[model samples]
Target: MKLYTHPDCEKHEMPGHPERPDRLRAVMQRLSESGMLDDINVELAEEISDETLAMVHPPDYIEAIKAAEPEEGLINVDPDTYMNNGSTRAAKLAAGACLQAVQDVLCGEEKRVFCATRPPGHHAELASAMGFCLFNNIAMAADYALRDERINRVAIVDFDVHHCNGTVDIFKERPEVMVCSSFQDNYYPNRYLDYTNEHMINLPMAPGSKGGEWRKRVEREWLGKLEDYKPDLLLISAGFDAHKDDPLAQIEFDESDYEWITQQLLNIAEKHCAARLISTMEGGYDLNALADCAEQHVRALI
Candidate 1:
């Protein structure tokens, strides 16, 4: 497995932000302390090209985000998301990390890759930016995997606290891409699970649902979708915010739950997609839970 990250991810953080530097710090520290950090090849992600980003996001929106960078004070794009001086580089590296993971996995250099970077994607849309995301990194990776690698039928399985509304919107009509999400319903940006596309399988869990309930949805809904789709590649929007310890969301899940879900996904990927998997970091607020759950997710890759 390949590990993609950048120190710049730590730089773009807003002070006292839920998606702060300590989140990455705790995750990296846990991997190192658990004697797992040295087991994989660590690659500093390169900058993604403009053309690559434009495949998923509009050029004007990209330029607007770049222009929104503040050299001095925070520029609040919304009540929850803002930009500091470091946001541009951090966003670049975040998108680049997923892009690199896709390239490496498709080239046979690595069968699976984990992008441990920040400013999480999933909430980001084609022409809008919100939810602390400046760019939809995994969305760009999906486009790259389909277009550049010439691989058809890709799928994104998201288990975030909130739904991947942006991903569903982008690929709703595109049969080649399947989107499965297990997120809290009636949460921010409201719910858009009404899309007519059967490929977009959304299992909306109520707030405060436990890991067992979440896992059952994965087994029943997502796994069935995975079996039927038989995707050429499996992409995971790996978010750990639903952990009981997470400050931002209400759900009960531990590291073992993360391990179980990853193993399940990996099993399907192994059977159908040549084990070509790219997992990208999304939301996880509580540092300890995020770090621990992320390590568990990584253990399956190892």
Candidate 2:
């Protein structure tokens, strides 16, 4: 397993916000204290180029995001999203980390990779930034991976409390990519909650759903589709916000739930994709819960 992150990821912050820099700080601190970092390959993520970002986002939208960055104070992009001086670079690096992970896993340099960057991207759309996301990081990485002829099919599994509307929007018509998202029903970014297809699996659990409910639904809805698709690579939008302690939602999951889901994905990866999996951080607000869940996810990856 390998870990990719950048210091700039910690620079994109808004005071008193749930998506604050301390989120990453807490996860990193826990990983270090648990000696998990010592067991994995850690690399600083580079900023993604505009050319690559353009694969998912329009060029003008890219320029607009660049222009929206404030020099002195934070600028609001939406009700839940903000931009600061370091926001652009942080978003770039966050996306870049996933891109690099794609390259590394495909080239056989690593089997599993975890990107512990912030400003999660599962909510960002092709031409808009929302839900604290500036770019669709995993979507861009998936598009980048498909460039390699060897990777014909890719599966993206998102277990976030909120829906990965941006990911579903980008790849809804692309048959080559399969998106399986399990999120809280009637939740934030409510777009595409009712959308589903042969390649897109939207599993929406009711509010107050427990880990067992999530597991049964996933096993019934996701596992068989994943096996049938037989993806060449697996990507995870690993969000821990579904935890019982998270303030933003009403789900009851703990670190063990994360571990269980990771193992399930790992089994599929090992059977079909040479264990090639790249997981990037998404929504997880409670600092301690985020740290503990993230650590367990990484430990399972290891």
Candidate 3:
């Protein structure tokens, strides 16, 4: 697996926020200390174009965010989202990292890629910004895969503790994209993924559910639909916030659970496609657990 990250990723932040710079720094440092970072290729991602981001987000919304980048201090865009001077570059670079990862996989340069940048982007809606996300990186990456690369079917599996309301909203009406999200029900950004098109699958787990419960739903729902869709590529909104130690959610998931799910997705990818997978950072608040668990998740990609 190839890796893409940027220093600007740390530049976007809010004081005492959960989505802080240390999240990326922790993961990167752990991967390095684990020796996994040395075993793979690394690339510094560039900025994605406005048009590429606009593929999923509206133009006015894009301009609003770009225009919101403050010259001095932090600007609160929403209850959860904030922008410092470096936010615009950070968000663009995050999206660009996913773009490069997808292109790399489709071009056969790598079997898979993990995008390790911030701020997490699952809760961001198409025309709205919330949940510490400025843009829909994974959704835009999927759109980039479909429109520019001509990939027919792509399955986005969001394993975050929160529902990917943004991704679902973007692809709810389009059959070409299939989105399966496992989130904590009755939580912030409550489940709203609904459409008769049969393109979106939103599974909200109970607050106290553990890995055992998660496995059942994925086995019964996600794997079956993914196999049926026969996606040309697999993209993961890989959020480790479901870990037991995360403060944002109450679900209990260990690193073994993350490894298990990654293997399951890899199996489907190997069976249907050429083992091409692109995953981006979404959520994982606990520094220690997030770092350790993310290390295990990336190990599966290798």
Candidate 4:
């Protein structure tokens, strides 16, 4: 497994925000302290070009995001999304890191890759930014893989506490991509598209739901769908906020649960795509829990 990270990812920040730089900092520090950092291949992320950003975002939307960057202080792009001086670059790098992860895994440089960049991108739409996300990183990576990697299909499995409304918006109609998202139903960003489309599998869990329910849903819903699709690549919207210890949502998952889920996904990956997988960080507010749970997720990958 390869781990892609960048210090600049911590530059996109707002004061006292739940989605702040300290989250990634804590994750990295904990990985180092736990000696997990020494076990995997670590690579610094490269800056993404405008052409790459255009793969998913339109020119106008990209320009608007760049124009929103403040010269000094913070500027609000949405009610929750904000941009500082370093935000635009950080957002590009975050998205680019996902692309790099895909390139590494598909070209046989690594069988699996985990991106630890920040400014979680699942909630950012094609034309707009939301939920503290500026650019839809995972969606862009999926697009890149299909277009450039000579892969027929890709499966995106999102376990964020909140729904990946942006990613669904991007590929809802594309049959070549299958997106399975399990989020707390009627929670933040409550408005969601109907899951009538064959490619979209939305698993809505209620508050207080435990890992047993999540595991059952994966076994019952995801495994069969994935078997039918037989995707060439497995992309994960890896969010740790579903943990019981996280303050963002009320889903009860422990570090072991993350490990278990990763193993389950790896089983499907091994059967379908020779274990080609790439995961990018999403939402995880509680630092301690995020660090510990992310470690376990990576441990499973190795």
Q: State the number of backbone clashes in model 4.
A: 0
Give every collision pair in model 1.
Answer: none
Candidate 1 local lDDT, 130-179, one digit each (tens): 78887888788888889854588898988888888778767777888889
In order, candidate lDDTs are: 0.85, 0.93, 0.89, 0.90
In model 4, which runs have C-alpha deviations exceeding 4 angstroms?
A: none
Instruction: Estimate the TM-score of every prediction.
Output: 0.97, 0.99, 0.97, 0.98
Worst ten in a row by lDDT for model 3: 190-199
Which pairs of residues collide in candidate 2?
none
The top-ranked prediction according to TM-score is: 2
Tens-place lDDT per residue, model 2, 1-302, is 89999888999988998999999999999999999998999999999999989989999999999999999899999898999999999999999999999999989999999999988999998898999889999998899999999999999999999999999989999999999998899878989999999999999888888998888888998999999999999999999999999999998988899999999999999999988999999999999999999989999999
Runs of candidate 1 exceeding 4 Å displacement: 148-150
Model 3 CA RMSD to the hidden true structure, in angstroms: 1.3
Q: Lowest summed lDDT over 10 consecutive residues: which window, candidate 4?
A: 189-198
Candidate 3 lDDT for residue 236? 96
Query: Model 2 — which ten-residue stretch has the worst lDDT?
Result: 205-214
Q: Residue-wise lDDT of candidate 4 within 114-186, one digit each (tens)?
A: 9999889999988889999999999988999998646999999999899999998888889999999999988
- The best candidate in terms of lDDT: 2
Better of 3 and 4 by TM-score: 4
Model 1: residue 270 alpha-carbon error in angstroms: 0.5
How does residue 1 of candidate 2 score in lDDT? 83
